[model samples]
Target: MKKKNDHGVFAAVRMAAASHRLLTVGTVLCVAASVAVSLLPPLLLARVIDRLTAGLPLSFLAVLLYFGSLALEGVLTSAQESLLVLFGQRMTHALRSEMSRKLSRLPAGTLAEQNPGEVAARFSGDVDTVEALFTSGIISMAADACRIVSIMGVIAVKNTGLALILLLVLPLFAVFTRYVQKRMLAAQLDNRRAVAAVSGQVPETLHNIRTIRALGLEDYMERRYDRCIGDSYAAMERTNFYDAVYSPVVLLLNAVVVGIVMLLSASGNAQLLTLFGMSVGTSVAVINYISRIFAPIESLGMEIQTIQSAMAGVRRIDAFLDQPERTIPPARREAARGDVEFAHVTFGYGERHVLKDFSMTVKQGEQVTLVGRTGAGKSTVFKLLLGLYQPEAGTVTIGGVKVGDITDRERRTCIGCVEQHFSRVPGTVLEQITLGDPQITGEMAKDAAALAGIDAAIRALPEGYDTVCTEGIFSQGEWQLLSIARAAAADPAVLLLDEITANLDAETRPACWRLCAVPPRAARCSLSPIASMRILAAERSRSGAGNNI
Candidate 1:
């Protein structure tokens, strides 16, 4: 079943290549030209040797033709390789783009459950293997197969006895080649596993550096790392042993075949002589062909190894592309408004139900605070409101519209959430606030920053809002303040603050209250503890808004 899926992936790759007809046709032409051009050099060399044997002076044209064939073969071979690389790059680009699009369509649950390292490997490592599958695996194997068959056909025409010998010898060589490749592949996989273990240790050591130092476990860690390295070294040594043995065996076989052909050409029997007899030049060409054949045969073995190794990566990509995707609701134009309501809602992560038959409502212009101990489904409410997950029963609605049906663009303007931690993206300080939303203009960002009480600190920087942000540019508390500015920048109709003050000091805690003063006085606000309901009631009274707890 998995093999069938792999074949489907190959078919998809073929379709991707075919989409670029010009490149595909050019690559085919180059491969064909390279194979035809490769045969000429030895044949031309044979002619040159025959003239010398005849005591005939070689013409400049003959020398030019011989060397010229060699040069043409080199040029064609390079072109073929270059075209394959370009074609592979195009395929990789298309594949990655498709995967990226797939990510957007996948259920949020799928992404949340995925391992960051494994997901990264799909985009980076597995995608690279697919490229190798094209440039080094399949296409290279095809070219080598053509070269080998063409050489065999020539040998059959020129020397039947030698061709007969090759027919018997080649199959045995192929079987031996496959056996060696399989052994090498096993060693290579073991090496990769050991290497991955070694790679993982670096980050683990860094993350636990303080613990290691305090416990005096430095020597223990070093020994573990050393073991991983030793395992990798042993695996590589095994692979190297097979690699070192293969080439010499191939060359020895070439020499033996050449020797046998030479002996048979000088045999006493007329039949053997007729089958193997050749002019001095023909013998030279036949020997050169024998030597040439071994190279492609060796390449075929390696290409087989490459293809087999890449199949694992291909299967991973296939599974990713086949994951169940989220269903997109049709676009809605009406702005989200009115009371925020949760009616008989039930939700959970797998079998662990966080909220069951829960219901709540906060009217417009109302300030609501949910105060409870940890594991009380406070955070789950915000996730449901943000449409990260759909309720298993009933509905969560804003202004009579299902929250799950709200488009992402509308959600940004409709409901603002300040999470416990500020997620820093790669950009300037202003981008951190605006999040590159075109709708959040520069003026709006500045206003929200001022509202969150971070505008003064931002202007103090060398580049002000334009300063390229880096670590330590803002303290932990200031990053939280920046997150508030981000959430409020869109001037959302309702703000959901999920323990935003949990990480903030007393000095920074007051900045969160300014969100209540933002324009649109009717906008509702929901806050979850680390602030007690008593404090929220005080703020509500101070701001002259009805409070709900």
Candidate 2:
């Protein structure tokens, strides 16, 4: 069942936060403690200035208080960083795990629907962006807010009139900042898509580099790559242009605030002067608080960009996680025997129907061979019998059990398939043959290998069954032999081969045919083509084996 696509960035964060509640709480507390401790030094400095203005000697207690607060703040800052890092790492790990699980659950066509490089970028780049949000962006923004609030409290206590003036100036800066933030969010999201596009293009070109070189399409590849690079550059340019304008605007606002403070300090109206009641020491404290307030504002600008970037990544991830997943339900009934049937099945690929009212049956312990011309729905029959694609009408059943109703465990245990091309995974020979199935031991693999007549060849390798597989080491014939061996390792009762020898040359065809005839006791081998049937019949006659087709 497909997940809903409505999941958003906020939902992703809430999910992460729910899972790591303790860590989230710990990080927030550390940030609060750190900000509170950091605010102490400025207050202490103001106290020292007031004492100096009173023409009194500085107390040892006052100096100790300032230095002690500095030391404590440093420790709290370290603790906060540690907590944030721990939280970020945990969240990233969970997200990566979730994506991996999602990939496994996704249907076969997801890779074709989405760019492989873009999917990979989601794993690394997008995940890192989200991690940075938790680690630095969110925590820093929170700490800055605490600092600003603490400073505002100081300003209010020092002089209400000045505090009121600062408040009036804040809204103008906020309005300008809100405008910039909206632009930045849109620009950053575009930049992220551009980066993903570039990432997708690079791997596509590299993976097919051989074909490009062979076809003499080097210039075309270069042009395509250049276009992707240009897109990324244009996106970054827009984001940078907005960022460039922000700094100057903030500096101008800061200059205006300084001018207002200076004018207030210089004024001599009796009521205003009485309202000020501010000594040189108080003026210094107020000016310091003003800088603190604007410092957070500056940080707020950058942090908003970081947050927007992360939100973009989150949205991508959410979309991925929300896509339809292929799920295997629990088996309703066990297979009593290796009997395959497709009754009046209708199937199609999009608008093109491959099969119409197709009916076929292969009884238990029988070798059923099907032969037809290309595009005659031959492969589609195998796909339906294997439950790879759901039929548009009618039903497919194996051993009295509906194919779709069978669990993956029962299906894997009952049937095996060798495609025209098998995916080669990196592993030792035995591991690759067993595909890491714990139930299939090395001895089982060897038995299957021997039955398939590939044991001698595998044993001749450098490490026998433990030899590592790499390109060029195994011949095409040997690879085909390994594919057969891997399929046989499951000891399945029903084996499906879909034009497996379609890609093989005459030199390797005989050996492949011989391997196909080796396992037939309590097992069924379904082969296609008249030549394959002839070869299997010839081998069966020579070995006194069971039915060939």
* Residue-pair clashes per candidate: 0, 0
Q: Among all windows of ten consecutive residues in candidate 2, which has the lowest summed lDDT?
A: 517-526
Per-prediction CA RMSD (Å): 5.3, 4.6
**Residue pairs whose backbone atoms clash in candidate 1:** none
The regions of model 2 sitting more than 4 angstroms off are 1-22, 274-277, 369-377, 510-549
* TM-score between model 2 and native: 0.88
Across 1-549, the per-residue lDDT of candidate 2 in tens digits comes to 434533434555668888889888888888988878867777788888989989999999999998999899899989988898888888888788778887887766455567887898889888998998888788788788778778778788887777777789878878888888788788777777777888888888888898999999999988887887787788788889889999888778777877776676678876776556577777777777777788788888788778888888888888888887776677555453445778899998878998999888876546666666678777777777667778889998776777777777766656667677767888988887888888788998897677655689889999998899777767666676677678767656566777666656587665555555443231222363223333433454455432222
- lDDT (Cα, 0-100) at 352 in candidate 2: 93
What are the per-residue Cα lDDT tens digits for candidate 1 across 1-549? Answer: 124453335656776877988998898899999998999988998899999999999999999999999999999989999999998998888788778877898888789887555566677777887899889989899999999999999999989999999999999998898889888878866765676577668877887999999999999999999999999999989988988898888889988998899998988789888899888999989999998898898888778777766776777788788887777777987777767899999999999999999999988656677756678898898888888888999899888888878887787887877888899999999999889999999999998888777899999999999999998899888888888789878867677777666667777655444444333222222364222223433454456432322
- Displacement of residue 531 (Cα, Å) in model 1 is 12
